[model samples]
Target: MKTLTEHDIRSSFVNCSKGEAKRLPLPKQLADIDHWDALDFLGWFDLSAPDRSYLVAERGDEVIGVTLRSPSAKRGFLRRSMCSLCLTSHPGSGVSLMSARKAGRAGREGNSVGLYICADLDCSLYVRGKKQPAPGGRMEESLTVEQQIERTRGHLDAFLERLFV
Candidate 1:
């Protein structure tokens, strides 16, 4: 991910309204984020508030952001579940189902799309072997690690694009 200024982040959203973007809280440590290039996507979730999550994904030279809402946080499930974007599994609390309303009129009418994802949205790190894949994920892809990273980003970007279309 490229280093984004406040304006870039607030203006890049494809699925949220301008007012919503303006009001959304930014990471308090924004100036201290030293490694923007190492990030595949920039995201954050509010643990205290639980229902809100935000993401800014890099698509070529452009950035696209979306605001997501989780139905509710289920604190205690015994089973491990896989994140659709990272293809990694974790204890129930490590992943969540987040829904983002569609862009423009569809969103105004309350239409949204949802998917299970890593609670922290660090798929870029997971796919690159920087972070571990879900507990049981196998190195089954014949592609090199670099290729896998690119593929994962492609899948993630495609999902984000759907919110706009």
Candidate 2:
């Protein structure tokens, strides 16, 4: 991943209207992101609308974006959930089911694709050890860090592919 501008991010959205895209809030401090190269995609939950989230990634030569929604339901504190992308386990509500509206006709028909993901949208950082989940939340894995990164990206790519199907 490379550093991206607000224009680049705003124009990459595939599932929302231009007006909506223009109005959608972007992550703060876009120019200050120090981990761009470590990211497979940029994802953030909207502060004003807690249920809303966004993700952007580069696929081949194109940058693609998607709007995601998460339910507001609470989870049991003793339960742990794993992100499907990075396979990192988080306690309680640390994992969320983020659903993105499908692109094209399916989206217009209210179709969406959902995946259990890190609630903070920090899968890249978690996998790279730049961030940590709760104590005892991380599982020991035989896969190397590089392998885990590749696996995470592969999972994200597959999820994005579902948007076009």
Candidate 3:
């Protein structure tokens, strides 16, 4: 994957208004993100960063397709008894926090860190009850939701590692 600039990302968006894309605050680390490894991004914008700042990504410029990530946080969503990715009922303590970014600068290098954790599971889709596709036929019989989540986590970890070293 090829890293993208704020301008590149904004231009790729098919649905959002140019004004909105331009106005959206670029992550101060915008130059720091590994835009290439990112999947079909819907959209991206900076999240306030002192303790933890994030860059939200979506399949389009619209809010409908989105994912939020914070390099500083290393934590995703909220803590829960179950795994949103796998839907496994862990003891609310088995979850993990993952973070990935470009290596040297946001886009200059590729490095990411992920921790097996028990943190808040606050993502809108996961919280509200939506399932993303796993590698198998379905989340039910094909592969456990936990496996799916792990798979994504692995992908993220690898991407991060690629960025890091």
Candidate 4:
């Protein structure tokens, strides 16, 4: 991953109108992010619009971005959920089900794809131990950190591929 600018991110969106992308709130302190090289994608929830979220990733030479939405009702707090991307288990509502509108005609017809992901969109950090989940949240794995990162990226790429279907 490489450091990206606001313009780069805004222009990378594939599933939303340019105007909507322009209005979408970016992650705060874009310039201050020190983990660019560690990220497979940039993802964040919109604080101003609770149901809205965004993700941007580099695929080959192009950067692809998508708009995602989460249900208004929160998930149950008593259940532990695992992120499909990083396979990290989080207690309670720490995992969220987020759906992205498909690109092209499918999207116009209200078609979308969903996945269970980290609520904070910090899969990269979690896989690398740069961030921690609740006590006993992380499962012990035989895979090394690099393997975990690769698995996470593979999951994300598969999700992104679904946007075009």
- Among the numbered candidates, top lDDT falls to 2
lDDT of each: 0.79, 0.92, 0.38, 0.91
lDDT of 1 by residue, 39-125 (tens): 778888765577998988778888888888876747576778777886777776777888999988988888988888888787777
Model 2: per-residue Cα lDDT over 32-135, one tens digit each: 89889999999987899999999999888889999999999969889999999999898889999999999999999999999999999999999999998898
Q: List the residue pairs that clash in candidate 2.
A: none
Clashing pairs in 4: none
TM-score rank, highest first? 2, 4, 1, 3
Q: What is the lDDT of residue 137 in candidate 3?
A: 13
Clash totals, every prediction? 0, 0, 31, 0
Q: What TM-score does each of the candidates earn? A: 0.88, 0.97, 0.31, 0.96
Counting only residues 3 or more apart in sequence or on different chains, how many pairs clash (N, Cα, C under 3 Å) in candidate 1?
0
Better of 1 and 4 by lDDT: 4
Once model 3 is optimally superposed onto the true structure by TM-score, how far is the C-alpha of residue 102 displaced, in angstroms? 30
1 or 3, which is superior by lDDT?
1
- Name the regions of candidate 3 deviating beyond 4 angstroms: 34-165
lDDT of 4 by residue, 1-165 (tens): 989999999999989989999999999988899889999899987989998899999887889999999878887778999999999899878888999999988998999999999988999999999999998778999999999998998999999999998
